[model samples]
Target: MRVLFASTRGSGHFHPLIPFIDACTARGDDVLVVAPPGLEASLAAREQPYRIGGEPPRDELTRVMKRVLELAPDEGVSLMTTEVFGRLGVAAMLPALEEVCRTWRPDLVLHEAYEFASVVAAERQGIAHARVAVSAARFSRSTDALLATVLEPYGPGITERLRTSPYLTRLPASLDPSPYAVTHRYHEPSRPGALPDRWGGSAEPLVYITLGTEAGAMPTATALYRAVLEAVSGLPVRILLTAGRGTDLRGLGPLPPHAHVEAWVPQADVLGSASLVVCHGGSGTVFGALAAGVPLVCVPLFADQPANARLVAGAGAGLAVTPTGGPADDSAVLGPDDVSRIRSAAELLLKDPSYRARAGRLADEMRATTPCRELIGTLDPHS
Candidate 1:
């Protein structure tokens, strides 16, 4: 069997596809990938390449994203879904992607959510394709809407086909259960690295802070970071904050004595010993924290982040600070009270054992998920 994998660029989006790709290669299937020049280089795939580079022009994407960022977090998802990922993405990726499908003629095209070109190309070429979920379950409606709107010109039932296709996800059923009938829930196959105990058996808890790579580029995230640092100040626990590469460290000013900032961390390693996590509620971070059984203080920046935050809070695994136009109380919109809430929430999570207990339960669910390697037979044509 031959499989082609497609996804948006970035670690968060790209990492979820690893399980499927690794499964295909482990079974001796030939594979090709369409993605940014990052870890995909390490993926085992066929040598011949497709130069699939038609991302929206930088200026236009920037102009559109400017408007997207300006809108209240709730108002932007539609525009982001319709334009950025839908219209622009289709125009940019479809031609070259379709050519790849026609040329390579793989038996299957597996894609991560938020990437539609591969699905369309597979439909056009009459090849089988499946989608892997990269976030919480609430996305299918908006995602289905986006595909329906973009796929009209190509053919009928393309959207419906995707809506009912085999779905794969790493999200535990407790987080956001899949609505799909043919869903396969599983954990990624890679083993987590060991975390070296810096304290050498000292009893102090470790708090992990990561706002995700995209956060570094956003000014809103800068303010959120400062607020989180200030909020956690004077706490007995030690803090390790991973400031993504794009963040303006100078803009963050001085850090509290208990907190140490870095460009990145071995996330799985850090989470191994972390007692609590403060993050932007990205799927990867939220998922990682849950898998590690670490509680969270989620301050959503945009997109599905707020949903992930609410999920964590609702599940009793963490607290969420979301946006509102109110004069006081709310994050990203109103200011100081948000920090107070974060502090209060963090304190509550640290002191009470319930939150950690709930998180541990979720972690058990995560580990119990069927291994991705076992599901490959379902997609493998030779089987």
Candidate 2:
């Protein structure tokens, strides 16, 4: 069988599709990727053939994204879903992506939840397709209406195809149960790798901090970074902060000797040793922390991070402290009070054992999920 995997430019949307793609390739199936040029470096490393799916012009994208950040998180998600993915993305990439579907004629098309072009193109071409979720939130409430409008060009009942299609996800169902049924639960992709060189197997509690891949580029990130550093200041725990790829450490100014700063670190390597994780509540970090049985202190910025944070907090696995008011107001500045709250939350989690116990239980539940590789056979359109 031949499989065509598709995603937009963002890392959050792209990572969830990897395990399934790798599963298809490992079985000797022909595979190709459909993505934009910004992701070439990431795709090149996969060593598979890919056609560049052109994206919206940069000026238009920048104009819209600027407005998105200025709005509250919910509003940001709404506009982003309708304009960015629903209209701009489809208008920009559909022609090229649909052409690929018509030409490549792969056995199946798989796409992340937000990559609207692929599913629409697959629908237009009558190809088999599936939806791979990036987060446990499932995006049902958020995307249903937008998809209904965006999917109309292909034909009637396009939304039904998405509904009945094979759905794969890494949803830790017990922690954040979906309102709808989860067709299949898949484990997060992981590989053993060396920890950051600055880390020295410290016996003291290790607090891992990461803002995910794209958060640093947000206008609000600088203040959040400063606040996170300040929140952990004077704490007894040793800090290991991954600043995301291409981040310049010098921009962060001086750091404490006890805090280890690196542009990148093997998350799997550090999660096992971390006593607690502080993050932007991106699904990757939230899910990774839970799977490793490490509690999280989530400072959600936008998108689904606030919900992810709340679920982690509600489950007693960790705390959620949004310096920017999270979904309420994205443009709000991080104040000292917010920083203190983060500090207090971090301290409480470290001082208490209940959080870790709950996190460990969630980890056990996630580990019991079927691996993505095991689900490849289930994608066959013909029963």
Candidate 3:
């Protein structure tokens, strides 16, 4: 079987797709990854067949905004209406997608839910296709409610359109593809892990802090880093910060002996060993921390992240903090007040055994759920 996988351009979007691609290839099926030119080399490095098809970098943001405008009003009518915007964002990539399908036809097209054009092209060709969701919270009931409220302005017709729309109704199924099969399985890697050079042999409780790859690039990066630094500075825990690529780490110069900063680290490696995970609540990071059974301190930035943080906190697996005066739902910012709250919450979780136990239970639940590889097997029985 030859499978064509299409996803957005960032690490967060592409990372979850990698496991499924590898799973397909391991089973002797050919996999072709369709993404932007920037992602082609990364995909190839992982030994997957890849093709680049997309607008130039300068026009990418403009195209995204335009796509949102086109899709948001019509398809955005559904209860979980933010998906309308997300789906529209995917739709913006249509031109590139058309070029790819015109050249390399595959038996099936497996796409991230946000990759609108790729799915449309698959439909135009009458090819089998499935949607993959990178975040656990995306498919959850909580998100459905939040999205519905956001789209409520569209009225009842939105529901009708969503059910009948070519975008959502046509896909065979949607998938959540994370490798941490169970919550308990989320833990520190054994040897030569992704920690920074300064973290070797540190005795303080470890706090692994990072914003998801793209979201980390926002202006809040420095503020969040400073808040965490100040909150945990005098504490017994050592802070390992992944500032993310292209972020200005210079502002955070001259770290204390207990805190170290790096531009990037393999998240799974660090999260596995971390005593507590402070993050921007990307689905991958949230699930990764949950799988490790380590409690979280989520500082969600945008999109479904705040919802994910809510669920994690509600599940007793973590706590959340946001800047004051921001939208109540907006948990992305870390103001002075939020900093105090987070510090208190982190201290409580660290001192409390119950939080750890709850986290471990959640981890087990995640593990027992369907694995992406198994889902693929079920999706393609012949394969």
In candidate 2, how many clashes are counted?
0
Highest-lDDT candidate: 2
Candidate 1, residues 247-363, lDDT tens digits: the string is 877777987766778777778889887899988899889988898889999988788898889899999999997744236443454367777887788899999999999999998
Error of 1 at 196 (Å): 4.6
Error of 1 at 167 (Å): 1.3
- Mark the regions of model 2 whose C-alpha exceeds 4 Å error after superposition: 196-201, 324-332
Q: Per-prediction TM-score, please?
A: 0.91, 0.94, 0.77
Model 3 misplaced regions, further than 4 Å: 56-92, 137-200, 325-333, 381-383
Q: Which ranges in model 1 have alpha carbons more than 4 Å from their true place? A: 36-51, 196-202, 323-334
How far in Å is the alpha carbon of 90 misplaced in model 2? 1.0
lDDT for position 382 in model 2: 61
lDDT of candidates 1 onward, in order:
0.79, 0.81, 0.64
Q: Would you list the rank order by lDDT, best first?
A: 2, 1, 3
The best candidate by TM-score is 2
